[model samples]
Target chain A: MLRLPKFEVKNPSTVEEAIAMMHAIDGEARFLAGGTDLNPNMKHRLFTPERVVALGGIEEMFGITQQEDGSMRIGAMATLANVASHAELGLAYPALSQAALLVSGPQLRNMGTLGGNVMLDTRCQWYNQTYFWRSALGFCMKKDGTKCHVIEGGSKCVAAASNDTAPALMTLGAELEFANATGRTRMPIADLWQADGIWNKKVAHTELLVAIHLPKPSADQRGAYGKLRDRGSIDFPLFGIAIRLDLDAQGTIFDAALCAVALQARPWPLKKAAALLCGTKPGEESFTEAVEQVAALAAKQCRPMPNIPGDHEYRHAMVSVYTKRALLAAANGDGPVHHV
Target chain B: MRVFRLQVNGDTVEVAAPEHWTLLEVLRYKIGLTGSKQGCDKGDCGACTVLLDGVPTLACLSLAATVETSAITTIEGLLPAHRANGGEGADPVQDAFDRCGALQCGFCQPGMILSAKALLAKNPNPTSQEIKQSLSGNLCRCTGYTQIYEAVVLAAKGEQV
Candidate 1:
């Protein structure tokens, strides 16, 4: 049995108090939300903080509200279950709801918070192992070891971004609000991710993600998400694709956004493919051409290391397949917007 | 060490434990209610599932101190209150599982039952797909999930074993 390493827990009733506590503890503390990820990671001996500040006690950070403009503001402490079951979210942003629903399974969705999922640690087959297992292999660059096992003599870690909702949120142009003892700051969700695995997020250590703001989708817009994995349930994605499209009255794509996950350290946005998709009419020939261009471009942009599940080549191949499917789903306006 | 007052199975129990103790550890070790099994000690497995304020939550990932104010219902608390009124039988979920042969090893029963109960309480009539989705977190290695799905269907119809 793996036991949680001993640490003091401090419960803060408000966000201000939590930030003050974090400041007081300085670098020795880690904020606790759902603990679905942090607890497991801690049990693996990946991180052992001196103090854990429990954010679940804060009542201010636990609900979803809508602005007068039809946009949505989601508290960071809201559980993934809440997000998945929210009627407004399901109707307004099916891609986000479906992404939240596809995260792990029922128990984890009930416990994990959207904030935690957005800030999920990058995963790798070599890094997400027990201490004994990792020690036997002499470790890797993600931990105490010197060299990366995934890439021979690699200079940096190539852990994959395994978060399911990040790509969807990025495609929707969401913004994240972060707070600390000093003040508050807000940035686009795309700006929050870093290309390096060790410091995967661009947020400061002292800052805490407080809420997320998503703009209301226009009537001509649609979105979808697709994930490939070894199992139908409980497995992290080997490949994930999220696509959002805005069509003009003539059935031509006016704007498009595409992002892929679990293929690189950051969610790789397919800007070239999206640029190619713009002004394309919705039809078999245009769709096929767009897919071919996307596949060719993604094959070059995506650099999957020999980490996580599935063969590197197979995973790369599925990236294009899933991208094509996601584009079709978004164009057709499908429900339960994610495909496995 | 911090002292916490937890409302478990309709009783207010006070326990002095370290801050690192999970709700699963406190319930099984401090309170001696071992019905909630620790299968993976992680959120991936639903064996440590319980009801927090009527919502299904993973107790293994919940901090004992954080949930002090919420009502907790474990497997041990699933006894039908009608037993005191002379209404006989186990909870409908348990009875259905027994009659439908929903267990081969019985290790996943407690979590499965709680998840079913929570689902039924929310939606009295769930489709087969809904049942599978609700229990996705709970894994039964022995029963191939067919019997488990049948058990939930039978339980939803208020059938007895």
Candidate 2:
């Protein structure tokens, strides 16, 4: 059994108390949402915080509610299982729900939180391993050592942003609400990332992600998510795509958005390809031709790297396949084009 | 080390363990309820699954003090609860697994049975997809999952296998 480094746990009833606990601690302290990801990383000797502020006791941060301005407020502590199967949230935003459903496996979805998923660490084959396995290679730049395995002596850590929900949330124009000792602040989800993969988020360690704010969708909005993995369950995506389509009253595409992940440090948005999908009707030859063009463009524009554990060329080929399938699924009002 | 109270197998017990030890460690080592197995000490494998407040939760990932107050139900608690309810020897789910040749190595059955039990409790009549979904987290290397699926379907039908 891999043992976790010794650390004290503090359960706070409120967010303010949680923040206070972190501030009071002298040594390294970290906020723990669900331990689905953090605990494993801790056991792998990736992190050795002296204190952990457990956020499970904060009742105020654990529900799904709608705001007065027709927006939705999803509490950051809501479990992925709840987020995936919640009736109202799924009906309004299927891409987010589908993405949540496709994360790791069933028990992980039950224990993992949405905030944890949004704040997930960038993953790499070299970085995310047991201490002995990693130390044998002298450790990479993301951790204790200085060598860059992914980029071959490159200074920048190129671990891929492996979170599935991020791409879907980006395409849906989701906003994030954060709280700190100072006060509260909200920002667009697309603006939360940086180019560097060692640490991707722009937010500070002290800032707690309070909630995710999803704006009300247009009347004729349609969305879908596609994921390609090695197994049917319990594997992270080798390639993932989120597609959103907006239809005019005449059932013609008025707007579209596409975002993908598992490529690099950030979720790459294909705007030029989205622009090519305008004014096309679903099932028409024009729309089919346009989707093929978008797929081809994605294959050309989006490049897969060998950051995560997979053949880059195979993952590269899957870009167009997933993009075209997800776009068609969105336009046809069908479900996520995922294979079980 | 710290002392805390946990409700496990319908009994309130006080145990002392290290601060960083997960609920799985306390349950298996300190409390001596070894029914909750620990495979892939991380959250990957479902062998450490137990019911917290009647919901399936991964004991390996949950910190001991974080969820110390939840009502934990392990695999050992199932047969006794069934017997208390005036039923036969083992729980129907366990019996179905035994009769259907589902236990090849029996290492993963504890978590698999618990997950299946929770599913049957919520929906007494689950389809093949529902059974497969419920058992997705529990990996069985020996059976290849056909017999396990049959066991769940038989248990759902209220048959004596």
Candidate 3:
């Protein structure tokens, strides 16, 4: 049995109360809503916080609302099941809903949160390990060691982005609402991330991720997410892609954003691929070319170590496969019109 | 330690719980509800799957303190003691599993049956593909998944296969 290291658990009913407790703990505390990610990490001794602030009681953090302007504000504690099943979200953003539904398994989706998924701890086969295994491996750069075993002599930790929602949200251009004892602020999803594994999120320790706001897609926009995993379900993506394309009245691609997960330290956007779509007609050849370019760039950006689930070559190949599928799904047309 | 209240096997009991103990540990070690087995302590294996608020979730991945107010129906309580004398009866799902020969060593049967019951309750006419997808997280080394899938379908139709 994996016993959690000694810690004090505090349950807070409001965001303000949670923030105050977080402030008092001087960042030694970790806020927990759905313990899906944190509990396992703690069991592995990857983190053993002295105090854990439980956020389950904060009812304000658990619903989805679509404003008059059409943008959706999802409370940080909203379960993945809620996000996947919300009629408004499904009707408006099938891509996001599909991504949410594809995560882990039914049980995990019911328990995990969009907020938790967004803030998912950066994963590495080397880093996301049991204490005994890490001890035998002499520890990795993401945890105890000063140097990274994944890329020896590399300056930064190269933990893979294990999150399923990050790429989907990134494609949707969501904004995150971060709260702390002092105040709250919002930022585009792109700005919220850092490529380096050591400091992936830009938020301060005192700042809690309160909600995720996804701007409604334009009338001409259509999107989809595709994931490739070894197992058909319950496994994290070996490689995954999320595609959001805004088309002109003529159906020509006017703007595009592509994000791939399990590729780098965070959801790595393929600007080159998006650029490739600029003026090209939405067709199979262009999609293939873009997927190829993204695959090559992702391969350059990633160096899969022996610790993760799939081999480096396999994961690299899946990038091309998943990206192509995602682009094709987006081009086929999906929205409220198509009950995805 | 906090005094955690749980509605386990149709009874309400309060026990002192650690801040980070999983529901599996609480059920197995503290309350002595040993029917819910713990295989992979991690969420991967379905050995510790249980119905939390009518949804199947890995008990190994759940914190006991969080489910203090939630309704939990474990395997042991699935069958009422006087099921034979029933006006109100045992779950049809359990009866189907028995008729379909769904267990051998029986280690994974409880969790498998519980997950199936959760699925059939919602989607009474699930396709074979849906049944497999629903049970994908649960690894049953025995039965080879054939009988279990049949059991779920039969149970959903209220038939003894």
Best prediction by DockQ: 2
- What's every prediction's RMSD, in angstroms? 1.8, 1.1, 3.1
DockQ list for all candidates: 0.77, 0.84, 0.65
Residues forming the 10-long window of minimal summed lDDT in candidate 3 chain A: A331-340
lDDT of 3 at A75: 97
Tens-place lDDT digits, model 3, residues A98-130: 788888887788789999998888888878789
Per-residue lDDT of candidate 1, residues A1-340 (tens digit): 6678888888998889999888786457888889988888888888888888889888878899999998899999998889989998877787788788788888788889999899888999998888899999999899888889988988988899999889989999999999977688999998988889876888875689999999988778888888887766777888887888888888888898988899878998989888988888777588668877876787778766678878988888777677777777777776433443
| lDDT ranking, high to low | 2, 1, 3
Winner on DockQ (2 vs 3): 2
How do the candidates rank by DockQ, highest first? 2, 1, 3
- Would you estimate the TM-scores of all the predictions? 0.96, 0.98, 0.93
Tell me the fnat of candidate 3: 0.54
CA shift of B76, model 2, Å: 0.8
- What DockQ would candidate 1 receive versus the native complex? 0.77
* Chain B TM-score for all candidates, comma-separated: 0.93, 0.96, 0.90
